[model samples]
Target: MSIEITVSELYDLKETIAAGLLEGLTYPWEALPKIHDFIIDLGESLPKDIYEERGEYIWVAKSAKVAPTACLNGPLIVDEDAEIRHCAFVRGNAIVGKGAVVGNSTELKNVILFNKVQVPHYNYVGDSILGFKAHMGAGSITSNVKSDKTLVVVKGEGISIETGLKKMGAMLGDNVEVGCNSVLNPGTVIGRNTNIYPASMVRGVIPAGSIYKKATEIAGKREGYF
Candidate 1:
């Protein structure tokens, strides 16, 4: 049997409380359904001094910066030093990690952004988990639902993994960089230390340490220069 990409290999659960709830799951998509409950539970445990409950299950850290125009709903936690920029919309069940940036016009829902992650500049990230320091460039978005409205599946090297989810999104590993205007289709899994080219439409599993120039043109990391 082929070795499946476990959650531990692609994410550090300690970074976000919601991610920790997915301890035994093999795929990241499995955590999508549990986000709402996880946030509600974690929000109750956050320290009052560091986090402030702002109606319902919405908890925003004292030190986090949120623009007045931003609309944040319940079951959300914005960690310390994180920035929710102008016009940003956080629907619910979102844990914006420490020092992360959700920039102007960005929309987030049911997502866990690990520490230092950036979804800056008109991004739409829903039902996804962005690992530590992962960054999505301007205008990039995660296409969370397929046109057919069926359960999402992840395909790898001649192997298929059924996610049994209708609203799955991308699972971006640590240090992954998605370029401008890219669209990560439902059930996309981008491994660690990978860089995707601008305007690329990506789907399926992209292995670690690779450079994705396009959906069909992926290359290994480059060797050291002279």
Candidate 2:
């Protein structure tokens, strides 16, 4: 097995309220279909003082700042101190972790964003799971569907996993940085602390602690890089 492709390798479960849901699965994308039900069950257990049920199946932390102009759908949760900026569209089946930022015009659907993650400008993230502290630069987006609408397949060095679904987006490991205007193609898996170049079209599984220039041009990061 490629350890980097597993849920335990890509994310710190403690950083998310969805830890219980994610922990039971080997791959992060496996949690996508369960997010709706998980949020409903979890929201009922959240402390009343901190989290408020805003609408049917929607919970928002009292400390989180949500813009009045934002369009939020059900089966969603915004954790403590998070920010949902102006006109952000949350299309349901989502979790925004503590201190995370969903910036202006960003759209989310069926996603789990771990603590302190940021998709802060004009981003469209769907059917994805972002690990702790991952940041997507302006205009970066996850392309969740293949052109032919076939089942997504995860492929990487000496590893292949058949994900029996047609709509799987990128899984970004902890502290991954996606540069401006980048597009993560369907079934993409980026590893921990890796950096992606701006405007790049990325696919497949990129290893941890590397810099991606292109599919054929990847460079390992210097030792001790934070």
Candidate 3:
């Protein structure tokens, strides 16, 4: 039997928790339900010299750049050097990693974005975890709910693992590049170093070091293409 992909396989736990509140969880999504509570716990521990509580359960780093037009709700942390572009809306329960970009018109909720991750356009990322350097091209978004509104199932290599949740979104691994105008369907799990072609509708699991050109066409990463 093939070993199923878990959150640890795709994300560096140390990095993801850099600004997060959860301490121990087997799956990334397991942390979702506790995000709001955890933020309240962690916000109290933030150093006053580096972090400033902007509102209820919301902490903004002293050096973070937040545009005047941006709207940030509570239970969130904007780390040092992170940029919240004009008109950005961070609903809550989000940890924007250092040097990350939450771009103009972008919306985020119940998400953890690792350092250097970029969603610098009109992106809607919710109930997800974006790994280090993972970039969502303009107009790319993660669709967290299934059309049928059933619990999500992650399938790869002919095996399916039930996630037991109805609202699980995409898990984008480190260095994953989601091309422009693409939609990552519910329970999508793209492995490390993979690239999704522009305007593609992606679902299920995309293996590591692969290029997803379409639903039927996925190619292994060429050695020299790196």
Over the full model, what C-alpha lDDT does candidate 2 score relative to the true structure?
Answer: 0.94
What do the candidate models score in CA lDDT, each in turn? 0.88, 0.94, 0.86
* lDDT (tens digit, per residue) of candidate 2 on 1-226: 1238889899999999999899878899998889999999999999999999999999999999999999999899999999999999999999999999999999999999999999999999999999999999999999999999999999888888999989999999999999999999999999999999999999999999999999999988887886
Model 2 residue 196 CA deviation (Å) reads 0.3
How do the residues 1-226 of candidate 1 rate in per-residue lDDT, one tens digit apiece? 1123568878778776466677888777788888899888888999999999988999999999999999999789899999999999999989899999999999999998998999989999999999999999999999999999999998888769898889988999888899999999998989888889999999988988888898778988876410
lDDT over C-alpha atoms for residue 19 of model 2: 96
What would the TM-scores of all predictions be? Answer: 0.94, 0.98, 0.93
Clash pairs for candidate 1: none
**Number of the predicted model whose lDDT against the real structure is largest:** 2
Give the candidate order by descending lDDT: 2, 1, 3
Top candidate (TM-score): 2
